[model samples]
Target: MTAVTTRPGLAPRLTALTKIVELGPGRLDQKLLSEASTLLTRAGDRLKLSSEHTVVALAGGTGSGKSSLFNAISGLELSPTGVRRPTTARTHACVWGLEGAAPLLDWLQIQWRHRFARASALDKGESQLHGLILLDLPDHDSIRALTDTEADRLIGLADLVVWVLDPQKYADASTHRRYVAELAGHEAVTVFALNQADRLSPEELAELVIDLNDLLRREGVEHPSVVPTSAVSGRGVDSLKSVISSAVSRRRAAIHKIEADLRRLEQRLSQTMPVGQALSAPATVDEARRLGLTDALCDAVGVPAVGEAMENVYAERSSRWVGWPYPRWLAKFRPDPLKSLRLDDVSDEIRGITTGSVSAQAAEVSNAVQALADGLTAGMHPVWRTAVHRAARSRSSQLPKALTEDLTEVAPELDRVPGWWRLLKIWQYFLVGAFVGGVAWLAVGLTVPGQLPAALQLLGDSAALPWVGLMMASVLGLGALSGIASRNFVVLGASRERERLEREMRRRVAAVSENMVVEPVERELGRHHAFYSAMRGLSG
Candidate 1:
């Protein structure tokens, strides 16, 4: 190959390709990614080797005369042509200069016998086509499997492709659908040769060229080139050679091929995913949404219900402790609200087990979680939106267990009883005892009225009986007043305890929300951010 320099600005593009392959799988279609995967693997090997020799392939279907064109271009019968043979079963290479081409040819997997070097050009001083390696590929529509296989393999690796078509098969279905359409946006390194044009009249040739270009346009080529040619008469042969020579001299066709491949991959990727779509998504949950989620989860985990149960428990226990003696036994028959729901006296463990009775409706939890995912991923690309939503749902099945465990840990905080209740209990018992004892003494005094009245009169003269009666009534009234105050205080304490329980329970449920939903959503957004950043580097 010639000592020409390759194009600049290619290393960065390759780096961009590396970024895409590394970050694509989780966010890209694997089938589409397979194209990038093959291209990237091929590009790396190709870039490591020589860039001076621009490999161009002449590819077409059977009876297209591409083999004839290949022989005409080489000025030698390198590829045998016949009606029975139909197509080239294997690839044949013709190189203008042989230097630095062995490694490239080896990489192409071309056999040694099929290789040809033009030594006559050196003797004749025809150096115009120097450093060019033209490949005669097998027919795309050949009945033999090896022909199609070799054609496909060579077509993908070639730096530039020269499609050799004839008047009859220029718009063939197999050629357009399988090959031409696949190379849609790669128009830069593509050339179309309308071979066997001598068989058509001048008007027909011009019209065929127009029809062929129109067909190429429909296949996604922007400015399709249809060079009319005749291998028998050498029509457009020099023009095809000139096109090959121009690419060889500039030495950018290899780099341009990679660039075109990258563009095509990027275009297909964008069709499925809008570029920079992740940039607009919300990365952090707002305070309002956080509160909303916490509230929802709190309900699902039965935080508010537990808190209300806490108050009922606190009040019920208070009745046995501070209630007046006459009615304190009634509290024993009442069921503790907290115990009935299996939240009574939770163990002081981080992973306390609670019953399913505490859970809210399942649909309620699902809606809340979905809402949270939707809020965070607004305006995100479908790829990342799906990822974020999936992340949010990744541990959703564990939510009921997580919430119950967290609620259990927080449940023990409500069981603490105030110390004042104990002191009040002693005071209430003393009053009940005093009141009962005084009534019993009065009844016994009535049985011995004469002695009791004489003893009372001796202690306090004529007013002693009425004064003793008034003293007994005063003691009864004081006990009643004390009982009323105890009831009021118990209610106040229980209410305060309920409020405290709610706050603590909300905190635990919030922790559940973070693990089950918020954290996953954030992690997904992080992936999207990285993916988009890599895409930006690629676009540059």
Candidate 2:
């Protein structure tokens, strides 16, 4: 993968991987993650089994002399070498140290009959190779599928691999492509042995070595190790031994293998999860989308309709209390704005009450919510955008009842009487009383022609007719004029109430939108940002 002078430790990378997998549930490729998890678990189990013993497998395709190399290294013919179609079918393991190696061998699935222990080989100049477990694996390019499969499995478990190649098979593009190139990032634990070198002249041997090195360098190795070895002549065997000894001495082959494997996996994840825009803080839903959602909710719940209703209901109430006393009772005949929309009562005060009120059309609400999701996740990956879309609409089922409850809490009081209306009513009542008294006195004089009260005797003499009639006309006209003048005040108050109600409705609708849409979408974006951040740690 990535080159850094000093990288973050294994624990952090492992932690980062776990974070990525956890946060990537619906928005990442699960198959890729599953393989990473399996590799981690398997690597852990292998590391726990043995670290002192380095398990190095000799792997090569058909007729590559892998068995001969194994025998030459172990100083014994532990593996059978043959030629028809498939040779070295079963794996043969030779362990230099038997102490703590049985468990590792068992885990590798090596049969006891095919395993060897060199516990007494200290006197054969093999002390330097003390902690090594060399394995001769089956031919990977065998005609028999079973042998090929066995070789592939064992080679994957090996900490270090020595691939044998002869003159004929050194340039086999298909073989290297299928095996060596696939392990591109694992150059630290790999070596290619150019075996059977006795067949070529000195000049030809040098040319073959140059050609083999060139081939391997093309497969992602800056400087490939191609040791020329002849099993019969024992040439270049010491060089191969030196490579194995260095790995065993460090006792870090197993750790290196896991590290390389992790890099490969992280690279795979990087391909799918684009390194997002540099995020300096936790993600949030933008203000434009938030406001848009609130506006939509206001429309959906008919805030404008409610505002109009408020003004009508307020004006009607005002007229009932302050109108001319003669028509005061007739105000009740008008329709109440709040009651017409079925919004006066609290929606959930009683159980199982459904709202019959009109709201903005369903399509408008749906489109608004969709727009919010689209704007919030504008440049996100398709999978993450899908998650944001789902989050935006997650609570859509509760929108209707929520809007109804909010409207109920903010609905204006229809029965409330203004403080000044009562004063106006009393003035009108006094004028009406004066008109009634004047009418009664005149009527008494008319019916009983001369039987007038002493105080009203002048009005009965027919000379008081003009003054008495003027007095009654003045009281009636004053009451009517007062009622007509109050109309302007009533209209002004109603308009103010309508504006107040609209403001309150918009505020409550914004709260509903924040709860149902904006918050959920932000949470999904937060998850994406967290995942992206962790992946950056892996690169470092």
Candidate 3:
């Protein structure tokens, strides 16, 4: 198993694991297991098999004498000892094949074997050497570098690894940096041996092992095991075998590997959790509504009638989003926007609130909507353009239709006035003009000799006038008066009619505006609320 120990608390670990599983099939969680897990599983399997086989795969750079060391341990030269870059291609497993442990070997799938039943071959064949399965892997630094890859793969699966080094090149930086440093976590399952030890004296061999151990310690191996041996003279080979036997008997190395692997898995699982504890639940509908979403919706529609309804709803549900704790007197201004909702008044007051004050709030809202549409069209897709065009056409059609329909509906109301009132107003102007004209005509008749003043004519013949002049004066005066009166009446009637038509048009336009524009806007605001809520949920 990996070197690190798991932190206390099974609940958190299990929670982490559950989250890892929840990540679905794409996650590679097994790689997250610690080396400890790997060691534990290997140990458990070995115990159940009733076998003490500790497979030690010897792996290192080319000419590291890995195969030679394998031959020294097995005592029969099972592997070719060479100075070539790549020593082997296929993996070579040397099993002890112990009695009553056949099932264990079968489990290990090591069918290829070398038997040494007699005492003579026992020394020759390396069989029953405390039930250790030693494998000689290819060189890691070979021209075919993938050979090293296979060696590493086998090392992960092995119970133990005897990393064979040389006296001259034992301190090779490449070997230590690339392989030894990485195996620091598996110190229990790994051992470093200085091969070709015949080149040095006993004291030198001891010094070298001490130095190597110190180096391993610095590389994170707290207590590294190091041995000195020579495949040429067979020095210290028996000691190496003994160490392997002791590890096999206890199975510490295998268990440690499993524990490490499991630890790695645990860490990976932990990453998938909520970092420390669980997060609070997602935002609720009540919370969003409290944020003036409904009010915003009403404003988006810019309808006064709907704005009233939405405000009521907002106040009713405000308690859910914001807690209510005050008494009635204190609660008088409890639902204030700045104090509770923290919303902008300008945005909320898109619909006019006053009874009779003229408000261009609807126009303002429309302007805001148009701005938003323009922005969306530029940034998003051309579909917004189509949608905007379609809406404009629809609104254009609806407005005129609503205006004409409302004017028709309210026509009877305007027509309900008494006919006598209209006639009286007409007669008042016409009769005044007619009376003035008649007076002027009689005056003109009197100005001439015989046109008028009949009382004067009876008084004296000297005051008498010509009959022809009276006739001419009387006819011209009557015609001129008739023309002037008719012109004045026509002008007054036309002006009054124009004023009446304008007032009626204003009333009809207001009704149509309420029904056609404001009503649909409010309905659309409701739809906007639903749409935004669904989108928010989907995003979360």
Candidate 4:
């Protein structure tokens, strides 16, 4: 337990604990939160600021004068007190003043109760102790487990605990280990009373108090106020009452207990949170692993095969635009690459892709993602590591369809005809018309035996036929040059398109990884940080 000077009221502490639960959720320990929640509710319900009653219990081991001290303080024989070992078997409560304390006593589960009225003439300055409900609980180290359990439960519920110790058992191991040692942060609500001090000599009593103080300091109860009291002789009992009276007047025992409870929870939760640093996502995705995953996806999506088919399509289309007119027509017999693969549709439906390769790619991607998740969550808590892994593989089932959709959308861009290709197609058609016309003129001039007809002679004489052949040769040569240029141009464009498609595929893969893996991991890390901050606030 941690000690702090400033005690937070119950409401603020409860609110902070609630925020921790809300912010952390699955990332924090469930059992810890459950226990904290139970304590928070108990504190809220038990501590009523408007109600002037203060519940204090005297908890001690057998032969510790707990019942005797209780009877002396209340000035009534409500609790059984004798030399018999473990005299009190049950809890008994005595409420001061005329005010009603039934609800508070009922909350403490104390059925046997006594009411003590303040005598105005005798208790003139003691009006401050009006609403004190002092209880004498059973011996904490009772022979029966049930009696001990009852005492333990009531001690936990009490806003302030008066630990009554006999001179003989003041340093008992069981008493200190089970009760005093555990109430480290609750030192403000704890009062140590050295009962039966009349038996010891004054010097011995002084020495015993000094020794008890040293023992308590070693037990982690810092600077504890130990009062020497005698239940039989009524020595130091008023001092004990004054301590209780001051706490009651201040009405801060409940707040102190609640703060102590928060401190206890803070100490426990701090162990679970990583120390010295906050959790965050990795700066960037692992490039090599991402590329490896993309390559596997490309194989499944048939990218290499599609790229080859694209080159072939460009070759065939370029031939039609600028190849020798005779063979250019032969290229039309080949099917379009994208159309043959049913990739040209660009519709929402995924078609013509094999499931086996896609499934294999999904498995490969899963493995790569798992590796990335493991690396990211290395040295993390098991709960957070499990969360990161789950986030990494969250959308694995839908990946194949998403990849296929993205590939189909980008596939149609490969078959896009450039403006240059269209312009060259028109030039090739004009050249073909000229070549055919020149051939027709030459054929007629050679086959004609008699004088040529006037219309044909006007077109060109037989001597002009050489010029026609030269003109036709020039057209054919230029057409061949154009075809060569077009092939290179189309091939270069196809290469660039292949690179672009690969880049697009990689981008899509990165998107999937970001959404499915990176984002989820970061969210969990953010929760971890927030939970840590909340714990810090509560602890402080």
* Candidate 3 Cα outliers beyond 4 Å, as residue runs: 1-52, 85-88, 98-128, 264-540
Candidate 2 lDDT, tens digit per residue, 1-540?
Answer: 111111348667767777887786766778987876777676767757867788999988778888888999998988888775333358899999898888889988999999999877798888889889999988888778888888888887888989899898888876777887767778788888999998889999999999888877787666677789988788989899999999998887887877777787888887887776424433887777677888877777767766776676667567766777765546457676447755444222211112435444566677888988877777777787788889988987777667777677767666678778989888888988889987987787677856566536665565677788998898878887888777678988889888888888888888888888778888888887888878886665
lDDT of 1 by residue, 99-179 (tens): 899999999999999999997776765587777888998887888897888889989999999999988878888888888
**For each candidate, what TM-score against the reference?**
0.75, 0.79, 0.45, 0.79
Q: In angstroms, how far off is 403's CA in candidate 2? A: 3.7
The candidate 4 region of ten consecutive residues with least summed lDDT is 347-356
Weakest 10 consecutive residues, lDDT, candidate 3? 274-283
Extract clashing residue pairs from model 4: none
Supply the TM-score for candidate 2: 0.79
Q: Which ten residues in a row have the lowest lDDT in candidate 1?
A: 347-356
| RMSD for each of the candidates | 6.0, 6.3, 21.0, 5.9
Better of 3 and 4 by TM-score: 4
Clashing pairs in 1: none
- lDDT digits (tens) for residues 140-249 of candidate 3: 66677667676766766677888888877777887788877766457677888888898888899888888888888888777788888888888888888878877766
